[model samples]
Target: MSNNDFEKVIITIKVRGSNEEYDFEVDSKVTVEELLFKFNEFLSIHKSSVKENQRYIVMVETKHDFIDPTLTIEEAGLWEGSILILTPV
Candidate 1:
């Protein structure tokens, strides 16, 4: 693991069908899939009603492109204030 592995960034989370947005401080080393799971759990904890969409397309929202689940946040080129979305697939 490199120094960037421990880099921390603040990112915004957007879930489809829900008007709410969440901000999370996370390590850049975490994989996209892991972030998705974390957000899913967070959604359940905050507002259980917002988990209507089981299948979602997670992406770096500002980029408007679907991100690979296996790639780490840094590897995906995401930076501070990036919006990660769990949009309907």
Candidate 2:
């Protein structure tokens, strides 16, 4: 593993049909997909809730388009304070 430190970042979790806001610390090495897994664990959503092919998308900000959570922060070019909006498709 590279010694590059994954700068700490705050990720806000917003589940569909839920008005809850959960925050988590993530390293640049983490992927959005992994974050979803953590979110699933936190919300206690069954695996069946996570659909195939229609995976959730994480928006980096107001713009910048959407990105797959499966991609690491370095690959997705994410930075600290970058708001990751998790929305289910």
Candidate 3:
């Protein structure tokens, strides 16, 4: 595969019920767990209540679809400039 297949892409992550939107760079090889960890870190930094213990789900805004936490970015069909919504489970 070409390097572009592993290239990092910029995506927007918006937490539902909040005015916060975070721009994150992620490679297509990244897994959903890795993405969640990043979100958890962001929450911790912002002092948000949605930490690691809080059960939450990530969905693709374009498709209104829930992403499998075990899937890789590519497997999840996430491309550059994708917007994901974070909602409580």
The candidate maximizing TM-score is 3
* lDDT, candidate 2, 1-89, per-residue tens: 56875677776766555576678788878887887777777555544655544456677655658786668876887676566666777
Cα deviation at 38, candidate 2, in Å, is 0.8
By lDDT rank, best first, the candidates go 3, 1, 2
lDDT for each residue of candidate 3 in 1-89, tens digit (9 for 90 to 100): 78655778887888799898888898889997788788788778888655565657889999998889899888999899999898877
**TM per model?**
0.81, 0.66, 0.83
Please report, as a residue range, the 10-residue window in candidate 3 with the lowest summed lDDT.
Answer: 47-56
**Cα miss at 56, model 1 (Å)?**
1.7
Which number leads on lDDT? Answer: 3
The residue ranges of model 1 lying beyond 4 angstroms of the native Cα positions read: 1-5
- TM for candidate 1 is 0.81
C-alpha lDDT of residue 36 in model 3: 75
RMSD per model, one decimal: 2.6, 4.1, 2.2
